[model samples]
Target: MTTRAAGVATPRRAWLGLAVLILPVLLVSMDMSVLYLAMPTITDRLDPSGTQQLWILDIYGFLLAGLLVPMGNLGDRIGRRRIMLAGATVFGLASVLAAFAPNAGVLIAARALMGLGGATLLPSSLALISTLFPNPRARATAIGLWTAFFAGGTALGPIIGGTLLHSFWWGAVFLINIPVLLILLLAGPFVLPEHRESGRGPMDLPSVLMSIGGMLPLVYAIKEIAAHGPAPIPAVAGLAGLGVLVAFVRRQRTLAEPLLDLDLFRRPMFRLAIVSSTVGMMSLAAMSYLVGIWLQSVRGHDALSAALLGLPGAIAVFAVSMIGSRVGRRLGTGRAFVVALTVAAVGNLLLLGVGVDGGVGFYIAASILIGIGDGLAFPLVSELAVASVPPERAGSAVGISETSFELGNGLGLALLGSLAALVFRSGGDFAPTLGETLDDAGSDTGLARAASEAFVSGMHVATIAAAVLLAATAIVAWRTARTQPAAAVGVSAEPVGARH
Candidate 1:
């Protein structure tokens, strides 16, 4: 009964398939933040050392970021559906293992396995959307929904985790992913279509190795620097990662079948979209991290209470993400970027008025503004990235776009988070994070007050820096939009790969 129009699948089937695909996307994003509220309980139960605890919290993201590109390519050569189903199996089994892990080491290993599965799920699901909805307008809508689910999952993670932790054991966080992923595993084969290049060459093993090597070290370096500030080990690892990436790029140029299609960067719109995605994510992630700390540590709200207060912002993000593409079409993509980023910058500036004593209203209002801006911008970036490439190369293009998101998230924490930490340290000899500072303050009211003031001061500086960065990026987006024609910025139906 299904029909095709200009080779695009029936809308009903495509939309149904999209529903199946988003299951993994939601789970993957949730896993990233779900641990936030559960960490204390996990520590109490597992008796992990500081280093082990860090690994349990971090290893999943590290592996997930590192493997995204290679896995995306793998999906292109094989089949997106095939890889996705396989990944779901891995992810589901790993989640179970993590839930029942007897020790910290086992949990770390299980989390890493989940990351490996996640890498496959993200890009494959996105690329599948490109295949499913070839019409430009439909594709934009699909990506917008994808963006909403992603943002919603991240926002819901702490709230969901806190809710589960109140009644169930700490392991309930990991257990929650099972039923959702199981639905994906069962329904995906029936609903999703298989898509792959007909004559793609075998994957370049060396390129894959180089990518993993470069990305793992680079992400590790960023995380280490963020957590403990600059050290010799992280510096060396970062330099080494850079060198490997340079070599990888050079190797790609020589290969008859490169792992990544480097030529995608030649398109101005593609390049601009990647940069926008990176910077936008960076600013959003930085603000989210700081706000979570500010609510819990400075405002003395419990995890559940703070999450409840932030729910309205989360709702704003989810609501706006659905309508962002329509807004872009009405205002023009360039003007849309300008308006969105400016709104976000204003939100960041509003944080400047927030204080240790009474800024709950300010914080809530600022979070909603920031959420709206991010919701309006992120979907456009994803759509542009996929639309800029040929159908056959959507997977590669999506890989780069998703990689930018991962890197941006890490860099935001490293760079801006580090800046905030420096300002806090300058105020006094204190622990690296506000939580630790308050914990150590004990009954010392004066010490707690000083720590709170210092934390707010640091948050103000970081938000100002974030606002400035967002404003600058918005300016660049404006210029890019003006120079490029409607088609160049992803408005036209023509594939950018054809132009090159």
Candidate 2:
């Protein structure tokens, strides 16, 4: 049997590799929200058709979600470093395409390419860090920083996008990704170590096809339902998507090398971590998109002003995440998760105060609380997910968990935002502009007032939903705490490629 080096050093190359890998997270997460703030500008200049507009906005996430699992599995078959470099190169090239696209169709295609690259970048980077940091404590710290930048990207993207749009066209958002990708491409080969299993497993082509087919329809149906009020076309598509999903699951069971290990979910910690992370992400994503509209359409804040208003949340997220490790240790994982959810629930309640009557102080306080709760919850959830799996399977575990968060972010926004729209229609407003929609219904007074009230109502409902999900997660986490010590070492003892 071949043994490997233990207690890997924190070499300069390793640190640089981490930096290079993090660029994708920043790019991906930034793109997720960057477009939200830029939507008004894009709509005005591009004058996109209804479907084209949604495509331009959502294609990145849709493609990213569809490809992540297959891409991760592929990385395991090939060398991770090779995949990362290729992904970085693709990402850079795609950014240029997006930046200069003449029409919405080209922009949508470019975004999809970027998402393809992102799927490769995300899982490969996490795997690289796992290979480089063998020590558990050191790995946790590294992962914490990694996770921080991922979260930070969402917060920072708007700030940067806001600044860019103030001077340049909306395309500047895509332009910004170029330099980051270039940095990764240049630095990756020298800095990042290569990782591949000793023997390559047979590729799961059937699973990949089924997954892509299943995810694409479902995501598209959700986006359509969000926009078009659950029409028959989307309804049928959603049901068909369910059928494809069932087929995918059956295919996975028959595969010699499954793309995703469904059995890992049998582990309690894995279940809780995925659920809680999904809920947290869903809540954050829904709110982030809605709040931008609130700031600009309702609150009458400019893009720059709206971005500035959101700074408190960004700062709070950074600060809280920095201290989360200590808090997790002190409170125990279950207790910490429950506490974080409770705090997030309180933050949501504060968002209820964001009526037309709210002042700057109200927005600041709400943003800070929301940001801090999300910051604290996610890293702990990520830790629990990987710790539940064996070191060798850590990459798969992490990838699955991250994928769940991304799907949840997209799904949550669709469901909650759609529900809000439905509620609005029932309440009587049908104006073309979002602000006017609220105004005619008497839910808001001024332009800013309408935006604030609309957001507050939508956000309140979403938060209540998220809080309910977290409450369930808390129960699961409590059960997980009892099994953690055993599971951590238990998983480590298992050999690679062994089914859970």
Against the hidden reference, what TM-scores do the models get?
A: 0.91, 0.89
lDDT of 2 by residue, 325-443 (tens): 66777766656676777677667666666655455676678778878877887777666655655555555666786787677767766766555554444433454336445445563
lDDT of each: 0.80, 0.71
Task: Provide the clashing-pair count of each candidate structure.
Answer: 0, 2
Candidate 2 lDDT score at position 349:
61
Which residue window of length 10 is worst by lDDT in model 1? 484-493
TM-score of 2: 0.89
Error of 1 at 379 (Å): 1.2
lDDT of 1 by residue, 1-500 (tens): 45555676556888999999899999987887777666656766887764465567567766776778888888988999999999998999999999999999999999999989998999999999988887766777789999889877766777787778767888889999989988998899898999998787888999989988987788678767765778999999999998999999999999877877787787666676677767776776667767777777788676678668778777887899898878877776777787788888898888887889888888888878988988887777777777767777777778788877766665666677667877887888786656666768999989899988998898899899999988998898788668753633375445655653
In candidate 2, list every pair of residues with a backbone clash: 298-448, 298-451
Candidate with top TM-score is 1
